[model samples]
Target: MFHIAICDDSEYDLQEISSALQGLRHLGICFDETWYQSGRALIDDIAEGEKSYHLLILDMLMDSINGIETAKAIRTYDVSMPILIVTSTVQYALAGYQVNAWRYLTKPVDPGELVREAAAVLKSQEKSDETCYVVQSNGTVIRRVPLADILYFESSLHTITLHTMREDIEFRGAIRDIDEQLTPLGFFRIHKSFVVNLSHVRRLSSRSLVMVNGDELDISRARIQQLRHALMDEAEREHISSHRMRS
Candidate 1:
């Protein structure tokens, strides 16, 4: 089931957004939503770690904290989840980009536009859910972790650790073996000892990559150009996909 969080200082606006989302059900999209009156309340709930949401719909203006600030905070916890910003003016559109917001809508929002954007985001998420990495040990499945949750993989002498936003799992494996298996699934062998999920990467420099969790991993000198091409290709594909969705 898709989980969504919507935050608005005005109770009326919250209800309107929620009502707009209900229109998605006609398209066979099933989801549950949580409502918050302020950005701080939404941030507090997410920090508690009890819930994970696939999408966030935020109002730009609010008391104490605004939508952009809220999105910035949430990105530290989850870099991949899509955030949709709702506001009254177009002036905040540039600010939305800084937080990597998926879409920005002006209010009072049109229900049809909200449905279309929300559906596009949720459909992409559903596609991601289909591709999961199964962690196994001694013929037993240890865990079936969704690729979206994994930040990166770290390899030591004889142990491979799977690092996610929540916890780390250690298992016996070779980094090369993992690279061969996961490289086809958006994972990159940035260094001999590290393989990172490209989607969770926040910043990439010539020599290192900063992951969503603030961990920096070295990039092999030999793979720098190839990695850059791969990133460019991914961005192009995403652009095409977004265009198709909007069209």
Candidate 2:
């Protein structure tokens, strides 16, 4: 089930959006929603880790903190949740991109359009769930991180550090084990100390690889040819997936 949060100062608009989202239930897109009359309340809840949401529907204009400002604050903590901006004006549409908004809808929203966008957002989340990597510690699941969010894994002996977009997580493990597990999932052991997620590799040279986060990692000479082939296969797979999604 999906968890959604709607933040709007206007009660009428909030109810309208909620009503539109209800249509998703008929399409088997079940979700639980929370309503917030102010952006501050939503931001605080997310900041305190009191709640987690799959999607956020926000109104552009509000009393103290506007939708754009609220989104910026939330991004500091959660970067992957989809943000959908609902506003009367298009002026803030470009601003929404800064927060990686999924889409922007004009006020007096068409119920059909809103439902379509909401469904798409939830569908994408479903896809991401399939690629999530569960992190376990001491036989207990500690975290469920999406593989797409991870940049690379750095190993120093038995300690494996997960370098992600948000932060780094250190755990006791061996790089070889991780490489064997993630190899089929678009990861390559570029060096004995590092297994890089090809999806997050921005550039590659004979000697090293540049990650999306701007960190450079060495590529072992023996693995260069294999890494290049892995990258090519990954690109082809991504291209085919994109085409299928569009069709």
Candidate 3:
């Protein structure tokens, strides 16, 4: 089940958001909601408590602590949690990016817009559940390798090799099929024969990717732009996740 936290100083605004979330239940979305009056309260709970949430809706303005500052504090402990900033002015919208907020809503928030953003976050989290790739090794031993452990997939002559943190495993599969399963989970196809996990990319050059495992993979000339975009996106995500672990 998805857990959501809403923090707003204004009780009226809080009620409005709560009502909108209730309406989502009819559309088959299930979630647990928690409300906080100040940003500090919510931040403290996350940092000090065991409860984990999927999303956070923060008010951009508050007397004690503003949403942006709260989001920054949260980033110090929990980076991947999706944050949606609610503001009455557009000026704070750009500031939201500093905290790596997933999205922002201008007040008064449209219920439909909020629902759309929430739905997108839920879908992304669901995709994250695809963390393992099942393959038959040597045509007999079945294995389920955690996707995070895999550095990259090398394809040649219709035989695919999974280069992981521990060892390499060879299997028969189509590169296209591997791409279909992993691309959505942050793996990038830098060349027709190589698909690298963005999280495992340690360095990048004009024509190659240096993986964390010390393997250098060639980047296709045609996929340079796509690879760059994927790297930037992955860096932001990794920044958040690492902070969470450190905190």
Candidate 4:
């Protein structure tokens, strides 16, 4: 099963996409779709904390944060999720290219087409599941963790603890050593004591960030700007990758 986020200001379209996705279940493509009334509401949820979605369906024309801008904001934190554009106008279709929209569907979307596009995304995720993150624990204990399941890593004094979706695993290591290894895998050192999985960041204040599991971590002043830039870059790459997928 996959989770999807759909954002649209109009109530009619929201229900339409929801119904369309629900119909896909018969084809064995299970999806749990969460609906948002506006782009801001969706982004607000994202900014508030880690509600993960494998895909996004956005409306092009909306008041205040339009779909493209909303998608751009999402791109800053998530670079690979598929984003589908739903609109009544063809003129807005090309604009989606800038946001790396996975596919564009005109108003009154065909249910069959939606199912086909969604199944394509599911097939892709199935092909990528074997990748894992291997790390050492307790000096000699080796652990192979699914990269996506890791929540964050906390270092206190000399011990490092991996807070994952499954459980907390503590081992002897320096934060810097793991930081060097995980940074390339979307981890960010927001503070000296914490290196977080940015994907798990649910909300942030001026001084701290709350992870998906509700644990709050301090953000050092020195790394604040760096963290913001990294998130933005992640979004940019996400949109770019969507285009590549289509190509």
Tell me, what's the RMSD of every candidate? 10.8, 7.4, 13.9, 14.2
Instruction: Assess every candidate by TM-score.
Output: 0.58, 0.59, 0.54, 0.56
RMSD of 4: 14.2
- Pick by lDDT: which candidate is best? 2
lDDT of each: 0.85, 0.88, 0.84, 0.79
Regions of candidate 4 where Cα sits further than 4 Å from its true position: 132-247
Q: How far is candidate 3 from the true structure (C-alpha RMSD, Å)?
A: 13.9
Off by over 4 Å in 3: 132-247
Clash totals for all models, in order?
0, 0, 0, 7
Q: What's the CA error at residue 13 for candidate 4, in Å? A: 0.9
**Candidate 4, 1-247: lDDT as tens digits:** 5778889999998888888887678878766778898888787766543455667888999998898999888777556667889888999899898878888999898988987887777677555543544445333213446677888888889988889876787777889987897899888999898988887788877899898999988999999889988877766777898999999
Q: lDDT tens string, model 2, 64-132?
A: 999999999988877787899999999878989999999899999999999999999989977876797
Residue-level lDDT tens digits of model 1 in 1-247 = 6888899999999999999999999999989898989888777766654445668899998889988989898777667778999989999888999999997999999999999999999899778656877655664433457877888999999999999988997888889998998888888898899998887889999899999899999999999999998777767777898999999
Q: Sum up the clashes in candidate 3.
A: 0
